[model samples]
Target: MIYAYIAVMAITTYLVRALPLTIFRGKITNKYIRSFLKYVPCACLSAMIFPSILFATNHIISGAVGLLVAILFALRNKSLVIVAASSCVAVYVTELLMTLI
Candidate 1:
């Protein structure tokens, strides 16, 4: 039964990825469609990552503070390393302060 379920899921996943390639053989020429497609990966990535960002820490408030710091760093066009490090630091400091208080 578990094997059957796994097979079904595998087939469904394969079909989803295969169908798009088979259907969209020609280049998409519509400007609006092109623009939307360009942002889809980022949108999808954000959707997947944003929730984890808020809940990864012991405290939601610390997580939010880290998220804010990360966003601020991103707005300034900081390097990925810098953004991530600063966010981690922010979360650590927030957590420490919360513990002390």
Candidate 2:
């Protein structure tokens, strides 16, 4: 049953990732659509990250720490790799301290 669940999730995830590229190939020439597509990944990432930052326990302190780290990385013009790594470290350290306390 667990294997079946994993298989189903894997298939669904693959389809979601592939469907857009497969269906939209050669169909996204519009300038506005192209502009919107450029922002989609950032918007999606923000939506995923923001909730944890905003509403997690110790909201203000944790969120501020994460936000500050993110902004610092951004200001440094760091690559996404660096930004993501730094943010993960910040969140992990914060959570660890929370657990310890």
Give the number of the best model, judged by lDDT.
Answer: 1
lDDT score for residue 6 of model 1: 100
Q: Please write out the lDDT profile of model 1 over residues 2-41, one tens digit for every residue.
A: 9999999999999999999999999999999999999999
Strongest candidate by TM-score: 1
lDDT scores of the candidates, listed in order: 0.95, 0.83
List TM-scores for all candidates, in order.
0.67, 0.64
lDDT of 2 by residue, 1-101 (tens): 99999999999999999998888778678899899989999999899777666666465676768777988998999998999789778977987898789
Structure candidate 1, residue pairs in collision:
none
In model 2, where do residues sit more than 4 Å from their true spots?
55-60, 79-101
Instruction: Report per-prediction Cα RMSD to one decimal.
Output: 2.8, 3.5
Over 4 Å off, model 1: 1-26
Q: How far is candidate 2 from the true structure (C-alpha RMSD, Å)?
A: 3.5
Please list all clashing residue pairs in model 2, or write none if there are none. none
